[model samples]
Target: MAPAATSQKISEKDDLDATIKKLASLKPIGHSSYTGEIKSGYSGSWAEKLPETTKARYARHGVDISKGYPYVPEVDKIPKFVNEAYAIRNEVYPYVERGAKADPEKKALFGAAKEVINLTKHLGTEIVGLQLSDLNDQQKDELALLVAERVVVFFRDQDLSPQKQLELGHYWGQVEVHPQVPRISEEFNGVSVIWQDYYRAKYGLHLSFKKAIGGNAQWHTDLVHELQPAGITHLHNDAIPSVGGDTLWASGYAAYDKLSPAFQKFLDGKTAIYRSAHQYVDPENPLKGPKYVEREHPIVRTHPATGWKFLFVNRSMTVRIVGLEPEESKTILEYLFSVYEKNLDIQVRFNWRPTKEGLGTSAIWDNRASQHFAVWDHEGKENRHGTRVTSLAEIPFFDENSKSQREALGLSLD
Candidate 1:
């Protein structure tokens, strides 16, 4: 039987003629239209060239000059403080590991409401079966301490609304309202929306650009450009992609431990200038509406609750070290930045997945002790939206008397 014909009829011959005409009229788009030609030879200009004296200076500072000015050899020799820190990390890991992998009967409970499960040897821990509203005063205090020491804590299938999330943030400290960005809801001024679709449209950003300009695809501490940056950040992902969009956090304590004792001591007295570059409006434009603000903070800051020192400089916000020449600061800052970038063994990567009940994962991280990077690989595929509340805390300070994380954890130097 023949199918019923519609009022509009398609003609194959006419369509073929149109397609042929369009193809014949098409102009060639050269490669140079999108990208510049690649230069084969390097310019030997003084600014572009590495001087012998500069190479020697970097070599004296323990850099591998043969590889390059900023390169450091990956030697098996471990720093004494790093070894001690790891010994401490190993000792604490067993208790957390036992708790994480233990039977349901043997799991450690926090105030009869939550079971603690360590996510990594250092950094993150998952507190299962806990509601923000259900936590008592004692539990809230303990959770604050836990987050301070662990750097970040995770919760699954949380039923926390914006109001409850604000309340939970208040238990630790004052809920921070972002100075520049607006709130997710006008009624709930504390919560900030982190919707990818909204940001992409708002900022006119595209995924094709490889530069770390508009989006947060790089590791950073929250609002380091501010004098008193947010101390803690709690994010609740309501919608996520089927794959990718996982967040990775690196321990500032571990990053600090990887440095040599002499280098660490050198950095103790130094401060770095962190500027509001990527987050502020029109970072690249000099005449942008919002002006950029810069803040200077110690390269190594002590955790007030834990009394342990951790690396504070981040590649995203840190511009230069004070008291050094621009070139010298660039070389040194690049080296310090590589410590966090290269040390994957000291980091934890979390994969986010929502539960069957439509309740997604919520993460609370101590921004003072850790840096995080959002994987932006899920662009245009799915929606990744969330609400965040940042908590205000004290200014970053270093106490000379404070012990290293290793020393504070009671690990022997040997």
Candidate 2:
């Protein structure tokens, strides 16, 4: 059955159509890349031509100039998606399921599941049976509520296609289109290709990791530099290794609870600055090196759907506490980051190795309430790839009356 056509979906077709588009930047990494042509969510410009000196500068920064940019000359009519990264006219989608039902919806959704297992005490929940592609509006609504409560929900053996996944993302909210990175294809604009190896090679990053820890390996949420940020980000790993290639997620609410009452109060209203993964060159100061897209968000934010406060800082993007001194902010942030990094019970590690081809696992996470890290333990021997769609939510805000996840659920620490 086709999704109902509402006033919102005027020009949208049933599921959406796509033509094969071979991106120059993506052809090098064949199997893991998405080559479908689709509509773009935002308008961004890439340099068609640059001086040799400028090209050398970016190449030195680790870009593979030989493969060329992920330029679709037929689609974009330009040379590259590299050189300078900046997005304009990106539409922010308002979240729909705010204050949606909490109890009966969850009951109905879970009752339909063959076996529903909580992956961890504080957060992750894995549901077996029921294809994600067949979920009705009500089920989708309930699933949204469940994700807000669980932090991250998992589904195995789903036969969902990229088109179906993109449709699901639209139903959830406005899907985020990352202009800086190469996604699954042009046809599925909002769906991003989650390939660590693609990124590692793109920037000439080292591919060696023997369970190494700290630094960028620390906890992170997606697209913090966006004005509204990301809400529920869904990832379906179409390809996985036989061993290793796991992802670990930690509950932000629990991280906040790990703090004392006094400490929590201190962080309750604090705000922080976050940087984007893609850096842009300042045209005025091209030789000064690239600059990151930075945005500000509250340190402790309350989710509109859950009515709970969660620690909103991640070590990767989150740089400083707005109102503190350099050393003071650094000192406080280290301790707060430790609360998330050190906690075992608040975290859930998921291994994405699938038994069958179509039975690959999908993880739907509430980016507003949790942080996650993809383990590089696979070491590039096996191909691990996934397509991701992130829905934009409301600009993060804090409400003094909002309770923590544990406090709201009556789940005691003792």
Candidate 3:
């Protein structure tokens, strides 16, 4: 006779079955109705009151932040989700796990793509033929491998809705819900609103830690302070300007290769301090004012999927190298920052232009192995808006045996 089913396994299966039923019941929220502040930077306490212009802009999305959170008029209609959400993280079984072999021919991925254009030798790839929403299970797995290999991948003119986008996030891994961050709606807290103008207004003084040097500021990885930081991050820009707004991504793998063998040897296994973009008050020492969410991680960390070591430091969040004095750490950190910032050969600039098939474009990147900077050149004058979903992955680790991407692929720095 077969062994009796354990209660835990039986419970998980029951929950999974119930969750599937609930999802089937969830109808497509009207595209426009997908609007509102389920939560946001605007929802919290702030110093400078929101300008009427910003408030008016957000109100169009059903966000009446005028009174604060529970911002929607029909908050009662929004079903309580804390219990439902835990299933995705705890029981649904995280997919696209680390340490899997990559599919080089990309039979499943490019089999559907019309034109696979390599944006640069090291950094970006644009998969022209595929629609993100329509990807099958096999195609989705290949897509994750492609992102790891290319550092980032682009999709043009996709019809991915907010709900479908959130579903995709769940398929990848644990969808991160940062209660403090600005999101599209309460119904979908995982979908973060990426409105530059409004976000700038919300975080004033706190944004200063990201000061510029050689005009190289704001290059960062998401949620590095979390025990398990952001891994595969999808940013779908449903709205963009006619010209002037582009995002730049630097390949962490290429940055590692730029360093000499001696430098690479020194950096390997060394740890550095990374802090959160948000700050919180230290209750024990109220006199200190506020403190950032900080974590110490390897300066040179390995990407589990690719088994390659990449420089993990970012100019914005990674403040200092561990075990080093302040001045010593600053000097070394700045040099490493420049390695990522100054190397044009290791970077790709993507212009978010969309054809008639969709509203805008999407860029899905492996935040664990790349850093991106959004060009704010539009001066907040144009409609450059998007929603991002960041999936939390493994706590970072440095494997001394991991190879550099260039070395592993037999590609020269030249």
Against the true structure, whose lDDT is highest?
Answer: 3
For model 3, state the Cα shift of residue 277 in Å.
1.2
How big is the positional error of residue 336 in model 2, measured in Å on the Cα after superposition?
Answer: 1.2
Q: What are the per-model C-alpha RMSD values against the true structure?
A: 23.5, 14.7, 12.9
Tens digits of per-residue lDDT, candidate 3, 1-414, equal: 344657778887777667644442342111111222332223544313334333433444454444453222142332223222222233333445632664666797787889999998768999996889898877887888889889899998876676777888888888888644556545667887776555454333122324321121268788887777788999988667778679999999999999999999989989998876544333344344335656788999998788889999887789899999999999999999999989888999999887763355889999998899887666556766677897787778999889999899998666
User: Residue 410: error of model 1 in Å?
Assistant: 3.6
- Root-mean-square deviation of Cα positions for candidate 1 versus the true structure, in angstroms: 23.5
Alpha-carbon error at 357 in model 2, in Å?
A: 4.7
For candidate 1, lDDT tens digit of each residue in 247-294? 989888888888888988898869988865422122233133223356
Residue runs of model 1 more than 4 Å from their true location after superposition = 1-109, 208-214, 278-291, 412-414
Where model 2 places Cα greater than 4 Å from the true spot, the runs are: 1-92, 102-105, 210-218, 284-287, 355-358
**Using TM-score as the measure, what is the rank order of every candidate, best first?**
2, 3, 1
Model 2 lowest lDDT segment of ten: 14-23
Clashes of each: 0, 6, 4
Position 186, candidate 2: lDDT = 51
Q: Estimate each model's TM-score.
A: 0.69, 0.77, 0.76
Model 1 residue 154 CA deviation in Å: 0.3
Give residue 252's error in model 3 in angstroms.
0.4
